[model samples]
Target: MTTVVSTGSYDYLTSALTTMPTPVTTSSTWPQVPRWLTLRQSLRMARDPVGNLNKVLAAYGDTVHLYLGGVKPSIVTRDPALVQHILQKNHRRYHKSDLTHGLLRYLGKGLLTNEGADWLRQRRLIQPGFHRQRLAGLTRLMRAAADEWVAELAALGAAQGPVEVEAHAAMTRVAFRIVARSVFGDSLSDEELMQLSDWLTAIQLFYVTTIRQPYLRPVQHLRGRYRQHDDLARRLRELVRAAIARHRTAQAAAPADAAPPDDLLQMLLDARYEDTGEPMTEHQLIDELNILLVAGHETSANALAWAFFLLARHPEVQDRLAEEINRELPNGQEVEFAGLPRLSYALQVVQEAMRLYPPAWIIDRVATEDDEFQGVAIPKGSVFSLYVYGVHHHAGLWPDAEAFRPERFAADAQPALPTYGYLPFGGGPRLCVGSHFALTELQLVLIQTLRRYRVLPTAETPPGMNPLVTLRPAGELRLRFEQR
Candidate 1:
């Protein structure tokens, strides 16, 4: 039987005890009585998860039981072994949790939110599109986009004194353009890209509020929040429809002898189900595209912004990185797809930055069947949060966890980590399909940006975490760009 622990009793019990509570003993039955958060604590957590999570870590150690009002108790864990068990070892017994289910309103049944057999099928079909060779072919397109952004920054730097820019916003525009060019090819117009970006930002904000604070749902509904979200989603769908129509028209206009352009949109349009040999319907295609647009750009943008922020605060590391980039690609030369491997320091810098500030800060999963780990009973339907941020910062896992040391990720110096300890892209069969894509983009952008300008810290250099749909800067990450 599940015992409901009241917050008042927990506080009394803790206060009454003179010594630290004994560690829970291993047992077939549920091991220890869980400590529940008070209603006030739950509300504060919803508003500031990263801050509260840090507090919980300090108070409860690696694992904690959270009780959100009106919702079932959930477990949050930072233990690498438990994380590995949930994400890799026993992955089949678990599925994407309600946290992702809440995204269905915005993303629909796409790869990011879809579950079970359909998700598996879609993953298999789309996997080929992100293969290394396919991504390699798009290197020139990626470089071209990076070059355009760098040139724009150059113009800004020349026109202004140490041009101040919001790194997150700037990176979002660049990343979105790269995804648009890579995925939809030339089918999307500039206006359409801007509209899609705006809509996505609105939808993300709406999602964060509704999902995090269920208690506020009534208030949000009264404010027509859902209507605003629906309107943005409708406009986005129309944009996708228009792009698809353009692709179809281009295909029709081409001569029979001419081959259609090899792009992500064409790739998806040409893909067929293995068992049924059927293609995705227009709606399905749109959903998949929406997922790509949302997933493809946002995470990369946050990561790039954070990487820049870290580099700005650590100028010595930035100087070393710039030196390496200059040695590899002298005089701001165009980056070749084949030459990416040579930029090892730049790659290390990106990896270390991601370690400190993983964009996908938390991963949630729900068990399909009752299970136990280390004598703790995990009931079926129990929500498990794999706290990526916590694990990355866990003192036991990495020495000097709070310090930003890119050298720690250097090939020769990198330390061994537990299976699930470093999950920037997550793990197991469901590992982010865009991992290689994102890494490549970060490398190119870093190479281009540093080669052109020195990213210096301003008053807002080291930004705080926002912890929304993704971990973004709590506020504007303002930085100065001085032309090198």
Candidate 2:
């Protein structure tokens, strides 16, 4: 259990608490609960890490100082307005927390987990990659990838009995391939691509193991797992360096006005920061590209797996989605981005799934200076973990919070959720740049998939959570695919 102490002036702390806009009054029941939490009871059940937040909030009320280990965990407001104020208005006073810094030893400071000027610069440069116009062109490529996977699943459903979905493996492969194709174009050979994919999967597993075994931090330096991550990083760096060299050589020999290839690598090569009048340095390119490969795939893969799981559990929802997909494509044709919104129900299914099992589940930040949040005084260096799962699942915020109902997102539906209540993509100035890209990919995959087969959970699969950097299915979330 972490214990957190307010080392600052006692009066300052009290004053800050007293100023809360809608402060918890002295007579409120929230303050009576014990600040320090024991590991044996509530903590054990919260093995998924953030799962026990809602329970804690329910018992202790909106603001509770949980002492675990030796750190003070101040679980504050789930209010959206408060969330926006913290993440957006007061963002300058906060940076990525220590937990994110620890994870970056493996992930690097891709836009997903970086802070300061470097993060700002990377976000600015990479934003164009996800621009609506840029993404629309990639739709054909995304559709082709989705179509191939759907065809494979359809074949399996017809030929095999109760085929295992291999949710993680399947989604990971598809997502990784799409990012690779978008970034590197044809620079990587088929064998090289497959090898990189396998290495990435291994590295992802190793990273998860390290994060799960919190004690691994001290001994990680001695473990083969740490070596494994280092080796994978080296290998990935080598591959990117080779690709960059190849691209440079090819570009130098090509005509000055030649049309650039339709790929992310070419786009980066051609791009220049307007203010700096400079292209991304080789090192910057490599780091950001690696970020895309890791960040892009990990979250999307988890979301896809969860969406499938949700659809499997709710067959009526699945059937409705399938009907919409069929109705749109009477001849069972491929879907385009322009027609993607036509699968509104499928989109809702994916959205609802993201709410229940957000891949980027926990958002963290470190206070740069003493800050006041809705009347609460947060000492400088104090870490704030926005429990997104807790917020999404809080009964006060979501009506029938745990139920799988997509219609809640239907037009004119009035659940009256808080501002940050449905932040699957985060919010404010630091909102996810690739949100549109992820949604586009998810919609196409789900629609094409439903058009091909029906999904049912496999008997061996259990509904468990894996909380690493992203939330994922803990075990083999296998499912049977029956051809429609």
Candidate 3:
């Protein structure tokens, strides 16, 4: 069993995990599995990634070299030390893999897909926008969105019959609305939000298909698959451009003494490169906005969907959560941004859900130069697939790895996990900029949700995993909401 230790705070818990020694030798070759085996594994991975990864890791140990249907060999690892080595210690020697590079057409060189100096520059300029202080200012906006969702759920419950709602779809709307309002204020219309969400979903599906099935590339090209996605991408870009244009128009019409609203778009528009003193170009801003919209909403929605699904299965835990919310936040009491720290159990539930189903289930990095980890030779240009799901579920690190247990993250019961053992938002310098923002949004939504309703499993409980651009539930997660 994993050992639990008292930690200072969630920030410290995340940033101060156990550290591992850096590798110093580059002479040993990694254990190589046959190409045929990898080919078979890839097929299984297409259908059931978590199962395939679990099997591969169990058989091959921490690291295994396998050819991934391309010229280069891929290194798949579930070892926390190796993960820390690649993602933290010698991170300068690696860049995001070609898989992420493929996303350039859709995401551009924004923070998510950018590399090297540009990435550093963007990270520095945009980091402050997501700082806890700035995020606190947006809690009202987030709570408003969550309130709307709860009200809608209550209405659904009031209808005579038991109401079954798709958890993913419901959470998607809430997450998107919170992100949209936080980023662009009320500039985007409902029609535009719907269009952006639809187009983004389509684009992600196309990207995943093209990346996973390289054999389909030729057929996709012949059928103008690129054109189809490109049209969708263009339309999304136009939506962002329209929002930006509206911001500018509104700014131009405002009185000189009036202050602009403090929001993500305003922050991005006002940010400047520290070295060059140059602001992001209009096109660049659009790319950044698109990245934010896609990243902000999609991953959080997946996590929240899974959280509710887990809660539905474990009504005891759900009841405990509702009890905590009721005891902490009485009737007519609003959960402010500052009050989030009090919702510890609610946060723990979300954290545990993410441990089971991290949206970014696998993170890829390409070696920028020859390197080594524990004598394993890592040649330059090799692709490393850090199996996050494998690590989070590793039997050695997490006892009862497959079980749903929120106490694993409880204040006094939190375990001392390895540095990279639980990377729902990744690790090291490239850690997600929106980690705090995402966590806060999730906690608020859960607080509002449980306060008004008890999430119960429907016939379709515990949805299967659909590993795609983000790890999503296989189908609509149907769950019944019992109003308090």
Candidate 4:
């Protein structure tokens, strides 16, 4: 049997790794759940990891050591302070594990995978792409994308009363459109957009499957599954390359005085390094485009899907949101980036929805050198799963953690949030560069959709958690759209 040394409030953990239920000792300071126990609970954990981990943490304390997949030794923590230390304050001591770098095999070395001074350089170079004025310029593209989806809903529900739609599929299309349009402008066609979405989905699905079931590597290699996915990734790169080529050709063909399109691709092409006074090489630019497309698309889609799901379930919330949105963007005015602050309730709802179901559910980091935080010892090469989902849901961090209360994020809300309690966007120096663009895009989508249709809950039960590369609903999420 695996013995739990302690279990108590995370606050006291500053004094020790954690307080135990049984007698504590120097050797047992960091208690490990027996491999056998981890293996025994493997099937259950696979089905409901969030719930299963919650049970283990409740018994073992905020942090515990265990074998991931009954094989690899690692520590999982729901402690906000620990998460903050790894991602921010003491981040230099930690780097992403192969678990994240593995994406480089398929996606290439972009900002998400780059490390050290190079990653810092790239961050500084790319930071300005999302500056306030830049995002304000992109709002038109976002609103256009959102309006198209809303128009589609109106068309669908116009003929049929309360048209039934799959929220995940719908949101996925809209999110992809928004990102694709923002990145490439009119460079890609609808068919190409669809193809890109399919390819990215396939690549991500295969990558996560391999990561989760490491034992399948040999079999996958022999079966040529890896080869097949690599081919898909190659084709994806080619499509992006073609877009770049087209942009270059057009830029060359345009009049010398004419301005190029105001989009992410243009921003990347124009950006020059501070020290070198040179733009990124074509290969580096392509890698970033790939990363941005994937990062910007899937995460936003999942978040949007969850937001609509919550709104459908909580009609009262939708009503309040409608009232607020109406009061702010009255007369059907579109969501301009500058006016986002006025839609405070919409922002709160988005914040709360992410708190309940964060897209980046878990983040993996490894200690680059031996380090210690509080009283816990972290040796070099130690693997840590900063369970962002767990941190968001930890009762000690959020009162009534399981409840859907958007007011918790209100301007004058009581009991302010803990340092790292919320991580809808992974925090620290790497806090998503597109955070402003994403928040603006999400609020726009919500407001536009609400203006056109009332997202009503269906008879279907709640969707199960499908924690893959990102947190997604296990299966299709169906909802009804009653045109308002």
Candidate 5:
């Protein structure tokens, strides 16, 4: 089916395939943007961020000191060296800036917001849940959820006309279903799952709005908007808390011969702290679940939505990928975990899709101690915006960077990929623990969707970027899905 084109270094998790061409200019002195200019362009920057940022980085050097939202003093950089230095090389000298910590007020101190020794402890405790073995156990759940989505398409195709669907909305449902099943594992009702998804979406939209439009805070507070989301957060906790109690009750009441559930929530319950050998407290477990639902759902949903959009436009690529699926899994054979490695082209599609439109477009960090880069002055409280989107699209780094060519990621492509140029998951010890889980699920959904239908493009204008907490399609990304 999928031939290995002379495997070199196939590990995209660590490094990219092709070498970067021109690195953005590096100046001896800091190339900084004026506060007055940044101020004038703040709203425009928010509205047309990917475009505006492209112009800014092209004019200045790779790393530039600019005001975040034209107010907060910060450094925005698309330099891979600076990114590696901050996130990995001299990581001890830094911590996540208060910009990240600010979420703790609403989301609780989960892995996404937690830091220091506590964060490490949490990571260690939860890492086991996403190990190869545990993920294998979860694969069946992912496939089942994908099947449910395809059944929806089956219904649409049966209607006689072209099977047009909004990809973003469709993938959102699929991602949410997989996450819901993986987390609760049949413990939650359909209504409860829908409610949970709604709450996460509403809270994230509210949080992004507050960060983007700081001046609207007083008006929002007067209208009790914050209070409304807080109430939603509280209700979310109650729902999770109830589910946990129900799980414990079910586990306790089950016959000893019956095996326990193999979902993420069970792993959290059974996980004991390394040093203390104690399970996570109820409150902490709930916090972790909330973060899990958000991370597992949002990024994968956006990535899949964009992937289908690309497939619709690139029929040759799609046909080749479908051929791989059909050959390896001839005559409707279901996908197994072991079978995934054979479908290499699908993974490349996912990788390039993410490269073009990374969900976590930017990462924020702050100096815990004074730091220097390439002779720049050491500052104690400097803030940095690691512009991942800028780095991925830098013309200097990628040949025809604007084009979507999955072959660029082929294992045996030309020169090797630059070390720091293709980081989708944030680097260092703080790298996302669920990276493998996300990738496996992404491949599963991609392979399954393409096997049964052909995604065709529509005449509607293409969707623009909605760079929120996650990069999403500005509106519904509609496409025609013809049953094959």
Candidate 6:
């Protein structure tokens, strides 16, 4: 028999649990619970996300039965205590759920999907690549790229032409390029870089579309998009193989006394595995590169697109940010590493935007062992999804929740807010390692872009949101840009 146990954080779970009259029935021999209409709600989540999920939270409470193919589903919990319990105290008892596992055909054994010692080892090997000291040097490169993008936008805005900002496409291409240069240095050609990027985008979109199809709910292997996906995957594998070969040749040709290239690829080549006294295998290296390409690029691009959409809607906020950028860049030159720290308000605006539209919007996990919280039991294998959007939008958790108010994050005010309440990079040990790099990238782009042009939202062309993998503006982002 299944039993419900309550970890006392009554007030925190109130928003999610208040609606339930009696604790839910859960047991080994209990009759199967009827499928609730709420199960269908997960489908509509990508459409009207925050609003719909809020409804579920308000209706079902903290822990409730959501019959997904006859099994219970656990949704959101505002209880920071329970969140702590799940993410830290007993993380071993939980692993990334199938939704993330299903993402593996595209993402490979990227840190986002893996667990246990392998995840630990991979994370350790890759962590130094994102260190602040190492990343500080990349800021100049990032700023230069941001300036080029700004100049293009400025010219379009000056023409006053209808600009369709294929935000996804544009950002995807640029982000892939950034990671390529930053991670691999000059080992990869622009031509090879673009080819790899095109295939990555195609595969990502294909995987996004195919995974959610309803009919494939039963026959996972017979999914229609697999063949096409395989074609793209095969192309990407070939491209990566070529790049690895080129990198080896470059290393071999270098002078015996020459220093290593100061790029992430070189860094990876130099990295050692304590157990084996050897570097990562070419296949493992490709998988890690695959991880960086997708996890690094898509997430940042989506976050930037969402940030721009928010800025477009709030012209006043954009202007405030523009003023900050202008003050920092009064010389009318492209922003440099020295100028980034001065753009504090611009940074806050981006931070608040992430709070409103986080790219990795939802995170899911499955219980490996039975667990309980506040008189509710989470059976082994039960799927749990943290509705980050729902938690961010919860009225009680965030005052004036829907409003885009960057002031809430003013320097002095930031430390006062609850830590987990605004988790754009997530919480616990699994918090994003690239967060420092992503934030630096966004800050550079925001400062450089806003300094050069005002991105005015088109009344006729509303931002299209497609919650495929990340929450992105669909149809590219079409904006009326006006040069500053």
Model 5, range 228-275, lDDT digits (tens) per residue? 999999999999999888888988999999977889998898999989
Instruction: Estimate candidate 1's RMSD in Å.
Output: 6.9
lDDT of 2 at 77: 48
What lDDT would each prediction earn against the true structure?
A: 0.80, 0.72, 0.82, 0.85, 0.84, 0.69
Ten contiguous residues minimizing lDDT sum, candidate 3:
1-10
- For every model shown, what is its TM-score relative to the native structure? 0.91, 0.87, 0.92, 0.94, 0.94, 0.86
Q: How close is candidate 2 to the true structure, as a TM-score?
A: 0.87
Among all windows of 10 consecutive residues in model 1, the one with the lowest summed lDDT is: 1-10
Q: In model 2, how many backbone clashes occur?
A: 12
Question: For each candidate, C-alpha RMSD in Å?
Answer: 6.9, 6.9, 4.7, 4.8, 4.1, 5.3
Sort by lDDT, best first: what order? 4, 5, 3, 1, 2, 6
lDDT of 1 by residue, 1-484 (tens): 0011111212322332324334343444322224454455766776677888877665655676666442556777787778878877788889988788877777778999998899999998898988887888788788888888888887776435688888899999999988888888889888888888888888988887777667799998899989889888888888899999999999989899996675789889889999999999999888899998888898999999999998998899999998988898886577887888888888889888998999999999999998878777788998878899998887666768899988776655635543466788888778888888889999999988888789988974367788877899988989888887
Q: In candidate 3, what are the lDDT values of residues 1-484, reduced to their tens digit?
A: 1211222233432242223222222347656767777776676767886787676656656677777652348888887778888888899999998788887898677899998988898899899999887898888899999999988876775345457888899999999999988999878888888888888888988998887788889999999999989888888888899999998898889899997776899899999998889999999888888888888998999999999889989999999998889888887599988888888899889899999999889999999999987766788998899998888887667768899999888756645554577888888889888888999999999888888777788875467888887889997789888776
Error of 3 at 119 (Å): 0.8
Candidate 2: stretches off by over 4 Å? 1-36, 41-46, 68-77, 154-162, 224-228, 250-259, 460-462
Preferred candidate (lDDT higher): 2 or 3: 3
Q: Candidate 5's error at 304, in angstroms?
A: 0.5
Indicate the residue-level lDDT of 328 in model 6: 73
lDDT of 4 by residue, 1-484 (tens): 0011012244533433334354222543566777899999988877788888888877777778888777878889888878888988899999999988999988998999999999999999988988988888889999999989888877775436798889898899999999999999878888998999999989988998898889899999999999999999899999999999988888888899997787899999999999989999989998999999988998999999999999999999999999998899889776777788888999989989988999989998999999998777789999999898988887666778888999988866766666777877888888888888888898899998897688888898999888887889989999888877
Q: What is the lDDT of residue 467 in candidate 6?
A: 60
Residues 62-157, candidate 2, lDDT per residue (tens digit)? 555554332345444455555666787788888877666765666566777778887888778778878877888888778877877877775665
* Candidate 6 lDDT over residue span 1-484, tens digit each: 0001122233443553454444344442222223656455556654665556556555544434455432345555544555656776778888887777776776578778778899988888878888877787777667666766766665555656545565556666656667777877777788888888878888776666555565563454565567767778767877877887888899999999998766777778888877787888887888788878778898888888778778888999998898887777788866665567677887788788887887877777788999876656678987766666665666655667789998877756632444356666766668787887888888887777777667777665666556666767656575556666
